[model samples]
Target chain A: MIKHKALLTLFLSLFAVSGLFAAKPVPPAKKAAPPAPAVITGLTAVDMPYDAGNAAILKWAVNPADAADTFYVVYVSSLEAGGWLEADRFVSSAKTGKDVELPFWAWDGSSLEHAVKVELNNTYGDTLPGSVFQFKVAAEKNKQVIAESMPVSVTPVGNWFRLDRMNNLVLLITIIVIFFWAVSHAKRKGLFIRRIAGLDAIDEAIGRATEMGKPIFYVPGIGSMSSISTIASAFILGEVSKKVAQYDSQIKVPHYDPVVMTVCKEVVKQSYMEAGRPDSYREDINQFVSADQFSYAASVDGMISREKPAACFYMGYFMAESLLLAEVGATSGAIQIAGTDVEHQLPFFFTACDYTLIGEELYAAGAYLSREPMLVSALKVQDFGKLFVMISVFFGMICVVLGAKFGWSAFVSSVLNLFQNF
Target chain B: MKLIKKQIPLAIVFITGVLTLISYYVPHKVSVDYIETMNKWENIVVAFAFLLGLISLFFSHYHKITRKADGWGYSIFVFIGFLAMVVPSYTSHGKQMVDGMLTPLGWSYKYIYTALSGTMFAVLAFYIVSTAYRSFRIKSAQAFVLFVAAFILILGKVPLGQIIWDYALGWTGQGVSAVIEWIMQVPAVAGKRGIMIGISIGAIVTSLKIIFGIEKQYMGKD
Candidate 1:
């Protein structure tokens, strides 16, 4: 009986402990959702100007409070009912109209408006030109949609003219007018071009080669024929070939571009014909070297060292290989005349070459060598263009300074914008 | 023959040139498509032109070998190099990687071609030093000015030179680097801009002359 009483007391104590640890019922806390963000206003979609009818620009006014951690997601749909595709997304503060690169004349570029360019021909196949499309934007914060914009419809059409590039067009037209005027003036009065020492030395170099009974190597450079420098080099080559033929000297042209070699064959042939030495003309004169830059330089360097050509003419576009070729020719004791528009390589040529033609001088070498009225006239046009640029820069600077001093912001901006590439 | 050789080419040049100029200012799809097509054609033509280069290389090297010209042995190596790259490229179907590993052609390019190219490029460093030595010989007034400018430029760029400059001319607030920056920004930029402007004008006028057929050097003599 005593043991039974002790066990009953222990059981009662355990039940009391269990009752103390059990979970108790509590009132459900009042949980409320955060307030919804303000809807974006003035939502509009328009065709992107100066593009190929494949993109639409969506714009809207954003609330100032939604600038941080707020994203604007753009959706595009061909049909208004369904098939909405997420086109692009960006932070609310990004890509304002003021960030658009369009000129002030073409676009207002207001700071209050947000802009997004949506390409229709994206991964989703909505690339039909002249097709109407619907666009809508949604504002989201913390991965939850806070507000949505009304769907706006737009039709992207290809524009014929780029209004933003009007400044460029005007400049081009002015250049064309000046070119014609200079041409007519040149033909009538005969333009005067300054003497270029490098070109004047061409005949002497060829003569030296002839006297020494050694060939003259003309490197047309590694540039393709489409390059302006190569075209200019070809002109100089023609004149040089004529002189070489007249002097009855051998000329070897090692080429890096095959098309240039083919064109050069005709040029050298024509020069020979003009010099009344077509019999002396050889197709082997223009040989193809390796297309690889270093390999080409190495081959030419080897040729210079072996043949020890009395004169070497390095013309056209060159890269790092300029110094290698010039130095080898210098070591071979060849009178080297190098011409290129590559400014960085000019120092190397100036150091290693006997005569170096600087930037515009290389361009002018052909006209200076040939003394043709028409070609010389082009040089005159270039001079006038430079003069116009100088005057404009000086006048623009003065006007800008005065405008800034007098608080003429509009005038100053107009003056500055006139000089901008756009 | 004259009509085919000269007239058609000139006509094509004029049409293409004008169209290209107009395309720059036109935003129409047609203009964009035309440019894209022309670029594609140019790339195709350039690829075909490579064959011409290969043929020319083969014939020239063959001629040199047959003549037993000086360094004729080098010409044989050209064939070896060409075949080394071309045969593997053909076998690999022009794929540089196979099963996440470099193909034989890729190996040749990485090992032989790249190594050779780098070696050749490395030689430029020596040449630069030599060229600088020759250039800064103080032969004339212009040379002296160039030497002074190069001295400051080099001195301002290195740490030891900067320390020396600070020690020598620390009293002035303006450092040698500031002077160098001014020189680069003011004179260097001004000269570069001037050259750029001239080059642009020259390129434009030359293009016009070519389109008008006044510059026929590219087409051979008149």
Candidate 2:
């Protein structure tokens, strides 16, 4: 009975200890699904600016606290399809607010390029031109979407006009109007234009050729009529050929292209006729040279060495052969006058040629030589356009300096924005 | 006859020029499509004009040969070369293989034409030296300035400049190169940009003149 009592006592003590320490195993705490991400706020869509049309812009703001480091995927759905397709995706960690353009049109021949990286600022491209598109943004975390933005809708249309380029359009119209006015003004009378020594020396060179009884050489360059330099050179050639005809001096023109050769032949002939010396218009004056670059330069150099022309005219679009021709002329001691719209070759011509017309000076030669009000007016308008650019740059620079000096950050930024938009 | 000579070309120029201007600002599908079509047409036209150039070449050489022109000997070589290449071209179309290699025409182009062109380009090296000698002569204030700039530019291009600056002049590293860079980047670029602005304005004026028919010398009527 005493042993039984002792066992009972031990069992009672064990039960008391169990009551103090033992417990039921708690079920594993359910992993709480990430709290639904805050909805995208202030989502709106508008037509994209300054493009050939069929584009939309979507803008939205995300509470930085809600979607701080989540990857957000943007989905676009057309109204007819009624199903969302992935258009672009971005990570909210890179940006909290967004202004995105939806590319909605494509040209027939050109393929549009699109970028989807969140950090890369890019355009939306390759959407159909005439469709309404709906866009939604979804925030993703840990391989599960936690939040979604309400869908925004927009219809892209081909605008007849681009409003963002309005400033440029106005500039164009103003220039045109000024050109017309100047043309009319000059038609009534004459205008004062600066005399270019390179152009004026053309007459002197022709006179020297006449005195020497030697031929004058003209290189019409390698480019064809499609090149502006070639056409302008041809015009100047016409004017100079007229003077040459009047002086009864022979002029040799070697061509590099067939169409340019044909055009030049006619121009020389017409100039001869206009100068009342049609019989003097020799067909051989403008001869066809090899289309090969170095070959033509060598041929011309050979001619220069053999004939020893008194005057040489290198005009139009020249290339690697520019220095070769000019150097040959220098050795021959020919009165070389070079004119071209090519900037890279200008230094070479300037060095070797006695007279060099640099860049726009070549374009201005025709206007100066012809002195027709129509051409002269173009010159006047060109000066005016330069004046506009100069003024704009000057005012912008002043604003920048003043803004920096006085610490007017707002004024500085506004001016900078204006310049950028322009 | 009047339409062909003047009106048609002018109308085409005006319409196409205005359309191109419009396309720059407006990205409409019709405008884009028109531009693409025109670009293709331009390429086609250029290709056809190549034939015209070849025909003219034949006549030019023929006329010279018949007349026993001063360079008549060279004319024969040109004809021979032209025919030699043309015959092989027609036979091979530049793709036919010969001896497990490129065709004879391709071989001629690669070995003969390319080598000759490269040789011609290499000759410029000697020409530049001679030209530089004549050009660097200090005759005037402007020329003196140009000569100095040219010297600096030449010095900066080679490592000898750095060696001379560091050893002889007791200067630090990149001394000559830094000055040259500043000159090229600041003064040279500024001058170049000014010239570019002038060129752009001139191009605009000339293009406008052509579109409006004010510049007709190119049309062979002036």
TM-scores of the candidates in the order shown = 0.89, 0.80
- Model 1 residue A51 distance off true place after TM-score fit, in angstroms: 1.2
Q: Worst 10-residue stretch by lDDT in candidate 2 chain B?
A: B165-174
Tens-place lDDT digits, model 1, residues A302-403: 889999999999999999999999998988999999998888888899899989987677777788888888889988888888999999999998998999
Runs with alpha carbons beyond 4 Å of true place in candidate 2 = A1-47, A53-56, A62-156, A287-306, A405-422, B1-4, B96-100, B167-174, B220-222
lDDT of 2 at A356: 95
Runs with alpha carbons beyond 4 Å of true place in candidate 1: A1-37, A62-69, A78-94, A121-130
Q: Which digits, one per residue and each the tens of the lDDT, describe model 2 over residues B1-222?
A: 989988998998899988888887776767778898988987777667567666766776788799998777777877888877778888887664777888878877887777877887787788799879977999999999899898888877889876776676554445787888899999899888888888877887888888888888866663
Tell me the fnat of candidate 1: 0.72
In model 2, residue pairs whose N, Cα or C atoms come closer than 3 Å (at least 3 residues apart or on different chains), thus clashing, are A52-B27, A103-A124
